[model samples]
Target: MRDLVAAFGGELPGCDTPGLLGWLDAFSDEHWNFRGRLGGAERDRVRVELPPRLAAAGLAAAAALGLAGSGEPAHREYTHLLILGGLARSCLQRADHAARLAGALRVGGIAALGSLRPLSAEERALPGLGRCRTEADALAAGVRAAFGGRAVPVLVAPPGDPAAHRANTADTYEFWAAGAHPGPGDRILVVTSPIYVPFQHCDAIRILGLRYRCGIDTVGFDPRLAHPPQPGGAAAADRCLQEIRSAIRAARALLAAVG
Candidate 1:
């Protein structure tokens, strides 16, 4: 896989520091302003602000690498690499989003998804977080139906693991079975968590590449300071960031090959 360390901003030693948020902030400053107003009473309305911010970040990063869309170049051509974060499982469970993404992709483009599976029935039976089960199941089923017979390449994490907890492995498998290959033309890369214990979705991509005979890549970054973190001292956040960077590099290489 091709490496794009510069695309991710700068490389730092050790994954301890919160780098993802730093990258996001740097990207936002160099690209566009990400503003959020707290006047809304509807929680959904407030929540809707996240996707745009993320899209902006992704777009900005692409731009920094000279991979973003632009009209100034007159006849500039570039492949669209769709990267979907593994949160809000609903986005993946519903086929509309996936179909829309597919439609937007050019013949030699790549659609990369980062997702997790729905909570199990047993997990859902618990209070508080239990409500998430229905949403997860619905999304999972929707995703399966959306690409049921399509020829989209997919990479996915295994079920019941932390990495696969919110990812749709079944959907990835279905797409792969439909003949999604990473070639000079359009393709899909469904990165999943590895089969090892304490699995993370990041591991899935590496494993899927080997299992399916597809070229693979990996990277990591820390996301804790940007979100919430666990109590006490643990290097989990650093490890995650390191893995993310590895994945990013791999993706860049794949893009270079296809471009």
Candidate 2:
């Protein structure tokens, strides 16, 4: 895999973030962080088959396993910009969907953002922010800045818990969405790291979609797992590996059922 990735553009591959960065070091493109997004036609196929399989999985998504790797709150935002900028733009090309997103943003559209941890100094200093500290601040600021008079994004973290974990944020979005959105046609775009997307979708559909009459679309923050190890332990690395593995198992099962 490393050799293939490095050979993609004739760059050297190490592992994880290093490999991605090494490729980028020799890479040139319109997009600096061009890690490809996951869960498209293939994901859709699995999704179509997944609902039926859920009953058998016992809701643990034991049906799905093998997935992980997301950076700090700020890193997530950075990744999101690379992925959604391209994706949302493509969806906008469709006049009907574009109009829907615009109208929804103005009235019924809700961009429900998951909670984030505190921003790093580097994150704060990133091109357009002033002094963003918390994940909510960064996301809220980012949403407003990006959509600008188009839509208002909300931080759906549980009260008193600004830094909710992945599992918790999955559920919180549904709660907030239920309140902020009521129109049957209301549109929701859930934003998070790519790895967390599947889990987020399952949680949202099971909780929010089942209860509310609305449309939901998700985009990964970024496609590459490029975050290097933190100071001490390999906890983050382990988690990312686990998540990848989990997503694969589930995705494979779902796809298999389709076949």
Model 2, CA-based lDDT: 0.38
**Model 2 agreement with the true structure over 1-259: per-residue lDDT tens digits:** 2332232334444566544533433442211112222222211112112233322332232223312333222111111111121112111122122222343343333453444444556446644445655555655555555465755545445544445332144346545655565446545555444445564555555545556755555544322332211222222322233333333333333333334
Clashes within 3 Å, all models in order: 32, 21
lDDT string for model 1 (144-252, tens) is 4445665443244344445433434334433433344443332333221211111222333333443454433221212132112222212222222223343343443
Best by lDDT: 2
Candidate 2, residue 235: how far the Cα is off, in Å: 16
- Scored by CA lDDT, what does every candidate get? 0.34, 0.38
> After superposition, which runs of candidate 2 have C-alpha atoms over 4 Å from their true positions?
1-107, 159-167, 181-187, 213-215, 221-240, 245-259
Instruction: Give me candidate 1's TM-score against the actual structure.
Output: 0.29
Q: Cα deviation in Å at residue 247, candidate 2?
A: 4.6
Q: Give candidate 1 regions above 4 Å deviation.
A: 1-85, 89-94, 104-136, 141-205, 215-259
